[model samples]
Target: MAYSSGGRLPFESASKLGHLNVIESEWVQSLLKDFETNDVDNADNYENDIWESFDPSSVQSLNHIWAADGSYVSVEENHKELAFVKTALMTVEQGKIAAIDKEYPHPLKLQEIMKDSALFHATVFPLRNLKSDKGNIYDTVRHVIYDSMRTDENGQYFETLKWLAYKKWDGQKNNSLSFECPHCSKVIETGIPYDQDTGICPHCHKEVLLTDMIGFHLDMNEENASDSVASHYMLIMEMLMLFTVIRLQWANKDTTLISDTLFIKDGPMTLNGQYSKLVPNIREFLNFAKNKERPIHIIGSEKSGSFFEYLSLSSRFVKPDPGIIKYAVLNHDYIRRVIQRAPDRGNPYGLRTNWGEKVFVYLDENTHMVLNMTTGGYDRSDAYPKSSDIIGLQRILATLPALVSRKYEGALYPIELVNGIASMSNYPSAKILQDFVRDAVH
Candidate 1:
């Protein structure tokens, strides 16, 4: 590799794989044919997911909002990987806004806590080739999960773990949790009470933590798992933090607060891969709360994803009138075939994982909301359009107009603030956190 006058004398890396084999490969040609086979089946299927002549639902607006967002960064050096995750749950009160100084543009502004927000949870993982306090990263990861779900930053009862246990057993303490033992592979039903975090499996006589139901231990071993597992934990913690706030409001101080609060999650209300086992319990709790009449109001907005991209392309026809808030109910089939480009095998999309149904809300000209909303229960219906099944649909939709953000194409104000707090910028954040980790290891 030599630099000439133009600084362009670098040779390409040698490859014995061969570029010509890409076309000659039989499997590559078969994959292309498979994609072409389903091209027509995934088109013109928007009738059921669309809503034309619709007005936003009329319900008492909930002014208080709890928005959650998180960031995960990892550093790998010397054959060791360390990951840091920070999640922020910001509480924004709509009633706090007041108009002032129209000329100076201070008409309405949220208080700036971007530099140092107190309402955040931080966790570290020794993902690979590293030792933790427990002598093994596997147990250390377990301990970290246990610690966060058990308490807030102030070391009080956060109750997210209890909430997980509470949801697992019919949203009540008088029930029992069922799980298959990893040691013996036998189904065990334990009535260990909801408050307790860890218990022994009756069948195998082995220790089982409440967090074991989350399935993180499946991939994690003493040998060392990938640092990518930290991102999955970040997602779980984001939801856990949101639910911790909601559960506290529902059970502890003011139960009425849950009704007046709008919960906003940055991404979809989904638990992917191994962590998806909690979906049933999540729906159970939502239904339980609805039956108790404290009914939760939550929605997840996707700023950029395949669904957002799909809506951007099809926005013209489905949502032309800016004045009207047109929406589409995304069925599992459309998601699987058209959006996801997978085989639609007649099962609900994210059935075992997602707690909310994906809906595209066209809010005026510039903003569109890709909301993952729950209608007080799990989505079991194979029905094409599920707009009618959504409880408090109008209230959730009506509340969004105030929360929209003009900074990005599909943005929300609350989510933006939380993202800023939770975000880890590469310039200083990564370098600083990595340095801290290196120094902390004596």
Candidate 2:
């Protein structure tokens, strides 16, 4: 018996071929346009001038701060109303004023009415000045309110607002120290110094490293130790700048309120490897602060490497200057060996080696021979290389004094020899060296 075969098409196959649950591209595009237009209109309607809209008398002096995960929300239905109130508070604190129509020209004017209305309750709270104000009732309440209002999509922004609040109230204590164990829920009470290696959590008995909490670990002897130290030192400088701006703003309450500060990183800003995610937010926050003119400064540190090479190659954007120079001082014998092995070409003080690469060598009384690898094998008797061609080396020499004054324990050689070798590979005459020393010493 031959029966007519009738089978339903599989949902996956139908969906894949755009036969089931398919969205038209034009429809999707129209929907996106609607969102885009709405966003633009909202942004245009947003009040840029918050100060004019805020009432000084209505200002709620937030004294106690709690850093809560900005992703939790209460399940209770009544708490939903409280969540709305909390959201309104957060929006105001975060510089997001409500869009007003003809009925409400100023949002603060509406806020005042809202504060007086039965629906809204106004409370005057005392501020806590101590860092040890954790586990307080007010903190717990604040956390509950924050968690109720926070959502997963806005979690990062919520955390950022929490960080900013912590800075305003506690002076950035949350970032500087850890009060709770990240791995364990145990509270750490020990007032450990920031540079300390570990803080013992009394409850957990675990050695909680401070660096682990602050997202940086210190190892002075690690390979590539200088890079780590340099990066951390640069961050410290930026943090100092941030603190300076905050202090300035706090001192002058009546002046124009500044929100964003700027930091100019010296090289291409990278947050790769262990610090990949943190660098972007740090840069963004810095840029935001800078745009607001919030007493911020930008700094960039440069050394000889790919970073400097890239900068030199793109010198059109940068002013014409000698590139940076980096040298490692070797023992006197080592220097002599290098110079002796360097095969001479017909050019004076210049050599062309077996590999057909030319090098210029100059021996200084400082027991160091300066080699010019960038200038090629050119004799000093020939046309001297442009001073601007070696700006990198010049910058290194210029910064040496400040480095030395900082008590940096590193190898050093005569700056004059380094400079002369950098500019002209033919070592300066003994008479010239003596005269240079006389001028430098005086």
Candidate 1's residue-wise lDDT over 274-312, tens digit each?
677767777777877888877788899887889988777
lDDT of 2 by residue, 1-442 (tens): 2222224323322345455343455665344334333233233332222110111233222221111001112223432211111110110111111222322346575344233111101111112221224543333333332342243223322333334323433334533333555345554555344333346666767665433333323212211122232343233323322333334443444333322221222222233333332333343344444344442322222334432332232222221122222232222222223324444343432122110111111111111112221221123332233333321233223222221111111211122112222233232222211221233211
Candidate 2 local accuracy as lDDT?
0.28
In model 2, where do residues sit more than 4 Å from their true spots? Answer: 1-211, 215-234, 241-243, 254-272, 275-281, 287-307, 314-442
Highest-lDDT candidate: 1
Q: What residue runs in model 1 are displaced by over 4 Å at the alpha carbon? A: 1-49, 57-59, 96-108, 112-118, 154-158, 168-176, 180-193, 203-206, 252-255, 424-442
TM-score of the candidate numbered 2? 0.24
lDDT of 1 at 8: 22
lDDT agreement with native, every candidate = 0.67, 0.28
Model 1 has an lDDT value of: 0.67
**What is the Å distance of residue 35 in model 1 from its true position?**
13
